[model samples]
Target chain A: MSETQQPRAEATVTLTNDVGLHARPAVRLTQTAAKFSSRIELALGNQSEWHDAKSVVKVMRLKAKQGSEVRFRAEGDDADAAIRSIVDLVERHFDG
Target chain B: MSDGTVAIGIVSHSPDVARGAAEMVRQMVGTSVDVGWTGGNADGGLGTDAAQILSVIEQIWTPAGVVMLVDLGGAEMNTEAAIEMLPADRQATVRIANAPIVEGAVTSGTMASTGADLEAVVAAAEEFGG
Candidate 1:
């Protein structure tokens, strides 16, 4: 038997920002992730380990450089919105 | 607007470092969280001054509490001394995180901006492990 799962969303976005996922971008990502109640996780490229999107320290430690692909996976009621925000933030170069 | 959030204090041996860290926090975390910083010796040299630290603590003191990040052992000691100088009641609300000054302040400020309490903010900073 298959168990029911909560709402989830996933997306992989390229880091187009000049600094990649450095301090400023990491801060923006974590702050955006915190706005949603969903549990959001981020991974670099094809890495198996996922870091909490709302954790600045963990997000920064990912060390995802420019042109790297960052995958976002969020689970919860607002998972879709969380993923959208993260993808948008990355696409916008984290300027917002 | 600053209510219900822990404040962040940055202490460094050089005044420039303290100011720059605080500025970075402000730029990254926005103005949602309060950030105060103090550095340099009493004579404007490169050292930590407990008196300066105490003033910044008092400036940013809130019921939510304040998390301090220090650059070196001297800064930590000075920050501790400054906290000790606070009234007994206020003293309990301040903490010195064992983390790098810039990273700790930024993390603490970001956590605090999310309405995190003192303990969580301190943990976020200390997670850097100096």
Candidate 2:
């Protein structure tokens, strides 16, 4: 996605990767999560608790399966840009 | 005393933990293996490594095939050649079907030492859900 098309508003995305959420991919996702000023939280499965995208262990605990919808939400000055990056990453399976 | 049964060997970076893990598996199964800490120590432990795999293959023999389990993938001695070098029966008899290496091995080894089968031990690691 282009910088201009970055999520202009706080947005949520569902991870569509076939492998579900994992470490190597999570590491890549977490790195992307940190790029924007907007804060990010990843909701795995149907759990009510939101986990910080920056925490590796927490992300691994999610154990998201293939087809599992993981939500990524960002809210802040660069929330749009941040969400765009996160979405792009999930789209590419974090380039795993 | 050996019972003409296949023997298990731990090929790891740390000799103590490797031997200990194998012994633990023995206690649980009542089938002790001759543990070999491949290229891991100066303490008179088995020193076969990836480079020495050919030489190591020349050493195993018996009614029970000698099994070599490693703690890592690319670096450890259980390369394709080593696996291929084992005598056909010994090769077939050997069981390296444990962990992927490092974390997988340590986790499985600890429990396998206590009698858990290779598969069960691997499952314990899966409990980590990675």
RMSD of each: 2.1, 16.5
Candidate 2 chain A worst ten-residue window by lDDT: A2-11
Write one digit per residue (lDDT tens) for candidate 1, span A46-86.
88988898889998888889999988999999999999988
Off by over 4 Å in 1: A1-4, B1-3
Overall local distance difference test of candidate 2: 0.54
Best by DockQ: 1
**To one decimal, what is the Cα RMSD in angstroms of model 2 from the true structure?**
16.5
TM-score of chain B of 2: 0.47
Each predicted model: what fraction of the native A–B Cα contacts (within 8 Å) does it retain? Answer: 0.54, 0.00
**Alpha-carbon TM-score of each model against the true structure:** 0.91, 0.41
Clashing pairs in 1: none
Write model 2 residue lDDT over A1-96, tens digit each, in one string.
Answer: 645443344445566776777655654665566556666787865667888775444666788877777777776778878878878887887773
The number of the candidate with the highest TM-score is 1
Deviation in angstroms for B36 in model 2? 24
Indicate the worst ten consecutive residues by lDDT in candidate 1 chain A: A46-55
Candidate 1 steric clashes: 0
Q: What is candidate 2's lDDT per residue for B1-130, written digit by digit as tens?
A: 1334333445665556665665545442233333344445445554435545434444543354444556655435454556667656655545554454433333333333334344444453343335
Docking class of 2: incorrect
